[model samples]
Target: MSSVLYQSVVKNYGALNVLRSLDLAVPDHMFLALLGPSGCGKTTALRILAGLDMPSAGKLFIGERDVTRLQPRDRDIAMVFQSYALYPQMTVGENIGYPLWIRGMPDAERRAKIDEVAAVLEIGHLLDRRPRQLSGGQRQRVALARAIVRDPAAFLMDEPLSNLDARLRLTMRGEIKRLCQRLGATTLYVTHDQVEALTMADFVAVMHGGELQQMAPPADIYDRPANRFVATFVGNPPMNILPVTLAEQGIAIGGTPVAIPAARLAACRAAQVVEIGLRPEDMSVSVPGAPNALPGEIYVVEPMGNETLVNVRLGGGNVSVRAGRDFRGAVGANIAVTFDVSNACFFNSAGLTAVHRVNSDGE
Candidate 1:
């Protein structure tokens, strides 16, 4: 396995900018997920790395080799496309061995490698079946097997599980994670799904508007987002941003004083914070007269299987709170929600994170 690097990469289409000054590095054997919404240039970045597309500017490297201008066949990388592009006329064994065949490996050796990879992916029994005869999940396994059979320097996967049903996606997620880990492959996986990115990758590089937002371990990305965009984009229901004012006591949310740690308050004051972010899981429903609570009316209540999500309309904006599954509340009902101010995030006028609380125990 080898490391992958993109230095000052840029992609442009006429007047439109698809990627801007992107500098990313995936260390040897690390799984890095390029995560963003549609048209965020994630796939474009992947294609550039795969040699299927060239960057408008900057350098691309696989290990120490410059591969920016190399042909796709010369990149020493295997790609698992979203479509699982298997030939319908070929059997699974043939599909998996195609890369080896093109490379002029002996037929017996190619077949042996195909069988070994097929067994690894639990698709050994289906090697004789054609693509049309296999299930979607099976076809996906074949795609993965083909990628694995090459033993390439790195792997590039473009939303390889997007076409699978929910259960199949879940199953494939685990399978892919384990497979990559077991192989110790340097992988760059592109997907718009936050769940897949967070669960499968060692590091996640978030992109927005053709620029890199933040790249970090999943836990750090979720708990200590670098800016308001990242704080709002990563979570399940997303973080809630509410206008706030510096109060004499500490900070004010909707005219109600909220107490925060002295250091955090001082940091907010230093940065001239304008807004506060609260994760749904960090806030809770409370009595109307609860101290340090923002009074609001319940706007909606959604009962998720394991927890209830309550959206409350505060004076400044609506904020969702994750509550106990059995908790019940009616829309328009008077309510107050409270959160640990230390756990909240403060953002400056420029939408950059001003202050974020870290656990005293050094998590």
Candidate 2:
């Protein structure tokens, strides 16, 4: 149970820079996910924390102790890689007890610790099975049991479930989250999968181009993205970003009128053109006469069993709207769409920073 912190961590390989002054902290017993695409420096940052890669500059700490110059073994951290890394010749019990054995624990004590971790991981029944005799999930459990057997100060995991099937990944997600909660160990997870980060971590640090983009809880990152890149990345269907003109009469969407409040209009006075963000589920299709509605033509309709996703063409771009399962709108049909003022996100024309939202009554 230790907190992890990195300050001004910079990593460079020759002339190419991988991380730019990266600073992050995770509280004791908290799970933080370092989430981004490949080449985003997330894996590099994880390796630096694990003491597997040395930072070109900056400081690293585990619980109040500055460990920038510490070796991997001296950092008191356990790491789990994507490949499982289990020895084919070793049985499950042997694999789980190897860490204790290498640390010079007595045979009886090593076996007791192995039995304890195996029972906690629910792999006690498979103690005698080799890696070849176990399923992928079972093998992964064995790998995790080995890591936790020593009770290290923290755990560093690099896409540990990336090789599993979708169903298995979902199951493992729950298992991993439960295991961390039960152990109360500070954990750092690196992955490109947004679902894994959102479903498992206490907080998510979104990164891009070796820079920290946004660090927030999953719901805030989804509802109020700091920038356009985050807005488009975190959601499944993604948020629809459309260009609109801010005016006293409200915003103009494809030559049609959509009324925004005077307060919001005042808040966005710096730009004549602003980018408005709307989530697929936030917009609804209606008849053409609703007040504050923007007229559009449906280009496609996809029935998703539980609901329907309607792609409507507004001018040259298309906007996706999530509708009820019973929605029967067809392509080529004219429809009006409206969204709640409070639910929409505003951004400057460049879509760099999130614009502030002010409601009606000039408040």
Candidate 3:
């Protein structure tokens, strides 16, 4: 496996811009997930990498070889699409070994490879069965087995597990991650689900409005977002972004200065207007005036058994606060919210967000 680079690639559709000067790098044997909401161009990026679509401008490389103009078959890459893309007429064994067959591999070798992948994928029992005989997850495994049989230079997966239920998706997530590790194949995965991106990939590329915003490890993207868009889009409940003003006394959120230790306030230089980004875990309900505390009302309570998400309204907007194992809160109840300044992130007036220190708390 070798590095893959998309050098300032651009794509357009008539009057619409699907990808804007997108540049990305996936290291050898690295599992990279392209994450963003629908219409963000993550799918388009995967298509370009697999050579199903050519870039309007800029170059693409697989290892050191340029592949910008290469066709899908010429790129030596296997792609697993969200639709499964399986042939209804083919048996599971034949489906899995289709790639090897296309390359004119000997019958004995093809059978050996099919048996190996089928055993790994636990689909050996279903080899004689057609795709319709298997469940969604089983069919997905067949799709993955096809990709693995060829031992291509890389694998491009486009939301291959979106159709499975929650439990099945979780099971398949571990299966795919473990398979990729064993094969040491450089994989570029595309998904709109943040949890999928966070849990499955070694690194994540967060995209927005067809532009690449940030690319880093999952923990880095979650704890230290490059900007507000990445911060809000990459988390489970997402980060809480609020408008604030920097006054001479301290920081005023919604016209009220939050009480914090003098030592902490002293470090912040007053800017005309600054916004604060807080994770749900950053705010705690506790004694008033206990280090950056603000009074707010609990507007919504969503119980998850292990944790309760309390939505608090303050500064003209509502934001969720995560409570420990089990903390009770009712709607319209007044609560004292205190921020863990050490875990806080700051953004400028233009809403360009940056985590204050990646090594602070949650380091």
Estimated TM-score per prediction?
0.98, 0.94, 0.94
Least accurate stretch of 10 residues (summed lDDT) in model 1? 354-363
lDDT of 2 by residue, 169-230 (tens): 99899999999998998999999999899899998999998989898888777776888888
The digit string of per-residue lDDT tens for model 3 on 1-363 reads 777999999999888899999999888999999999999999999998888887888899999989999888988899898989988999999999899998999999999999999999999999999999889999899999989988788999999999999999999998999999898999999999889899989999999999999999999998888888988887769898887766666678876686544544554453333667889987777654455677778898888888888888876478888887678877787886877666777776666763363356534
The collision pairs in model 1 are none
Per-residue lDDT, model 3, residue 127, is: 95
TM-score for candidate 3: 0.94
Residue 142 in candidate 1, Cα distance off native in Å: 0.6
Task: For each of the candidates, give the backbone clash count.
Answer: 0, 0, 1
Candidate 1 on 70-112: residue-level lDDT in tens?
Answer: 9999989999999999988999999999999999999888888
Model 3 misplacement above 4 A:
259-273, 287-291, 354-358, 361-363
